[model samples]
Target: MTYQNPKNLASIKEISARLDDPNLVILDCTSTVIPADSGSGFAVADGRGAFEAGHIPGAQFVDLERDLSTPSDHLLFTLPSAEQFGNALNRLGIGAESRVILYSTGQPGWAARVWLMLRAFGFENAAVLNGGWKAWTNAGLPVETGAAKARPAASKPFSWTYRPGFFVASDEVVARTEDEALVNALGADSFRGEAPIAYGRPGRIPGSVNVPTSSLVDPDTGLYLSQQQIEKIFADAGVKPDAPLIAYCGAGVAASNVVFARTLSGAGTRSVVYDGSLLDWSSDPDRPLVTG
Candidate 1:
């Protein structure tokens, strides 16, 4: 039912059963990519549009930009403040006891954002739909179209509570750079500034390992790999799961996808996301940076 730790994961059937329960809230976190060619843009749009055309009867759409992230900043989906987040949750009809199952049309990036945010606010019952929406739809479950009313009410009041073992800031990663055990969740190209795709400057933090976040998922299904599979991925990258990991992507969003995978590996590891990621890391001239 409720999962407080990362190690716990549910199958499509189990999550589906929970979705059938009226109390559980299924959130479709399929993101609308700005550039549209990043990865699964068209598919994500189709899934969401299809959801609007027909979803799991009561599922709600959680737009990555509008519902989960702030509109002011362009660096990426950086987290919102506690009050702002509470307001968003309230508008979504989320309460303290709400059981959320976050599913994305793409990989875990979008779902992971909501999961991390829920954990950050100390909501203990949130779970990410394993394999995301694709898995459910592939199973040939029922679908619905058109917007539905918010059941009995419009909004639910909720208060923000700080959650430990949930999130990490950029300075924390910088502090751990000297430890020699930390792994960087960015890609080889961006880590070396060879790609230079980010809005700010490129290049990764000093002494960080290059473990691209995309490596954790199945390209076709957009589902996370098995625990053993992920272990091998990390091992192939020369990373030890037992060590403390600080997952950081361009701006902390993508890295959370990696964190979700690592959590399912049962390594007794805690992965803290570097919230500022490359955006804040590159902006400051004083911070140490390294390139391959």
Candidate 2:
């Protein structure tokens, strides 16, 4: 089956060929998340060290938590204001005519998050590198080491157009209409509250359907499943083929993968990521959560 939105994904071959395109801006959006020492949740770590060790030639590293997200004392990966995001893009030399490709050394979710952010900010020329760094290396592609070279400025300034509905708040999730589906992108163990680790609470948002991001990719290849396979996964998860979906996870990172997967599957469905997700929901005792 053909992808519903083919432009959202880039193949390793396409990326390899475009390595020297003046308008191409490749970003390594890798961020490692390790289990917190306290043993309850996860902590975000900069992927610069890994990128410095080796990366796609001419590709710059993006610290998602540091470069793109807003500063939050309690939450991780909060959405940055349009101005802040625009400035970050400027520094990276992205412009109106630029083609941005995002990839991660770890989970594809890290790269998807940045892709979602760019989409939300009205940048339409960006795509996520399928299979990310794993596929690139497994294919024996050339790698570069050392810090990223300073990016030359874009010929034209990046125009910011704030789009609504790409990200929703907790209240929006709470007030979701019946036509909408609330999907949890965390693993089944977390969805069932059986996992030893949790963001804040051990349960899922009340009435959420499970569609873990991990299920969207081929385990062995680190590439997304075929379009037909992904569509079936969503249908099996109780999501109506045409229903709008509100996807959420620990701190809204994994949910982006869900959103991206839905697009890649050619499901032609509208999906939005809950910005705060479980981290925001569980912090408030008044909110309700359910566990199997």
Candidate 3:
């Protein structure tokens, strides 16, 4: 089956042409933990507030927490129910045949979560917008401000469905901790003996590769590197696209980033995510924690 271009954002000119099509639905995925005044490290910054302030004319707001994801200390954006997903799209005015173009406020990290979830749920027409809000606004495109009332269609067609991924259960993770091939997408500090920010346990999945998902994007451009660059990045991190790779981060958010990238690589290779990731594994006293 032909999946949507994993590198959709690389060609800005081509993607821009589809913006005006009637069958398309653009989503402003900018999300932040704190406002500008608070001086947080990095945040999507009032995503809904920003949407209300200004956004692409036809774009809709997909709140990461409230709308697209479920609340859980073990994981963020753990795929919602198919019915819930269908309702979300319908409420956002997304149609069955609509091509979803997701963009963020210069940060593709958070937005990538939605892109992966939508695709995993069998919505193949979805793609992430390149350069995110910065690209659109920089091009001097038409922008709309203020909240638009949802025009609930009397009978909206619901076609979104969830296709279970090969995600490994925490028990499997615990069992395979000594595999020496599991890849930890979290920070280096966590991979070592040092304690991590999100979990009580310090080390990583035994012998796991370390390639923080944040490294996938160009810091300045907010765009993913080319295919060659992606392959090289993974290779340097000891991640072989051909291997039976397992990706995990503090929660599953970062691991999803790697899944999106590897799927785009198209090498007939597959990687599974440890959905609970470190969150569930670390909290349990029985799960082994390895330190360098």
Q: Name model 1 segments beyond 4 Å from true.
A: 1-8, 36-54, 70-74, 153-158
Model 1: lDDT to the true structure? 0.68
Q: Clash number for every model?
A: 4, 1, 4
- lDDT by residue (214-251, candidate 1, tens digit) is 78777787666766788888778667767777777676
- CA lDDT of each prediction against the hidden true structure: 0.68, 0.90, 0.68
- Can you tell me which runs of candidate 2 are displaced by over 4 Å? none
Weakest 10 consecutive residues of candidate 1 by summed lDDT: 38-47
- List, residue by residue over 167-264, the lDDT tens digit for candidate 2: 99999998999889999999999999988678788999887999999999888778888888898999999998889999999988899999999987
The most accurate candidate by lDDT is 2
64-148 per-residue lDDT for model 3 (tens digits): 7678766665455566787887788787767766667888784475666777777667777777776677777778877789985
Candidate 3 positional error at 13, Å: 2.6
| Candidate number that wins on lDDT, 1 or 2 | 2
